[model samples]
Target: MANVTAKDAMQIHGRNPQHLVEKIIRTRIYDSRYWKEDCFALTAESLIDKAVELNYCGGIYGGNIKPTPFMCLLLKMLQIQPDKEIIVEFIKNEDYKYIRLLGSLYLRLTASSQDCYKYLEPLYDDFRCIRVKNRSGSLVRGHVDEFIDDLLHEDRVCDVILPRVQKRYILEETGEIQPRVSAIDDLLEDDEDTEKESDDELATSTRDQ
Candidate 1:
């Protein structure tokens, strides 16, 4: 089947990368109409066209556990196992939020803890509002940061149990990673600089008075 993983693809976490998604959900994706039609024979270069159309993220939904188009594309990515540089470009493409998210999810599934933290943590500042469809088939509003957080910390996201990610602190202690500086830290530093400027201006005015 064209949908089967590529011949040259390597195992992720000791199994097929597509296996990162649960078997039942993976089956649903394979049987999905979107998979049969839109996703058929899509190459890594061609897949970007479909990814730009996504507006929401989810696994199965409704009573039938229908896989979302987002999930279908995710499975295709795992099947193809596109080059890391290609996936990184997906995350770096700020013009399309779903494309960025698709890359982030792929990284969490296949990349190392260090790689995941390295690429994904920078997106904590994205803060773009997104639509997330739950298992119940209802869409809820969420931020980019929230989705990234769930991918990092939650055991399961969109119905797949994530691969174990080593605790960040452990990596930091072992010197594999440096201490994380959140986007908030940068914002606070900017605020302090502005406040100091105002204080200096006030002192100058008082001296002139």
Candidate 2:
């Protein structure tokens, strides 16, 4: 891990970097009312139920579905900011195509170059079919390969803007890139404390008034 270099990552991934254009999907996501829902407080354990109940992890059959759950869930991921570990866990699970797709999308949006390549490169080989809505508002069948390819090469996929990744560079002295700090545990704690404090303050103010 510490000894791994950028060259090693590239050699392992073999995905030569390229500049890509941002897709129009971003606009569509923003325009959808359901995408604006607050999902920041959801936990890894809690999200599974919501994913299932919302019918987010299944295939779309018709064009009439409004406020598509998958897109809404993807937007929720951006808002909630699940850490790398949770995202990776989602990717590793073989149960649901939509869950894995969410993981891949989250990684592309937030992971470092090395982490992205390390986790998502393997998903390119996943041939599972996922039904998606196209620009013409028609339900279409698309495979995992198509989704992963667009995420790898295009700046935006499924209406999300991916941050530009810095080229992998190795310090000759360190011999490895530093791993990103994980904040999921801390985020849960902080959010809980913040909510409690807000509730207390609201009660106190209301009593005084």
Best by lDDT: 1
C-alpha TM-score for every candidate: 0.90, 0.56
Total clashing pairs in model 2: 1
- Cα lDDT of model 1 by residue, 106-129, tens digit: 999999999999999999999999
Mind giving the per-residue lDDT tens digits that candidate 2 earns over 75-180?
4555445556888888888887778887887677666666776687677668888777654556678898788877778876764456665443442235445543
| Model 1 quality (TM-score) | 0.90
Q: List residue ranges in candidate 1 displaced over 4 A.
A: 190-209
Taken over the whole model, the C-alpha lDDT of each candidate is 0.92, 0.59
Cα lDDT of candidate 2 equals: 0.59
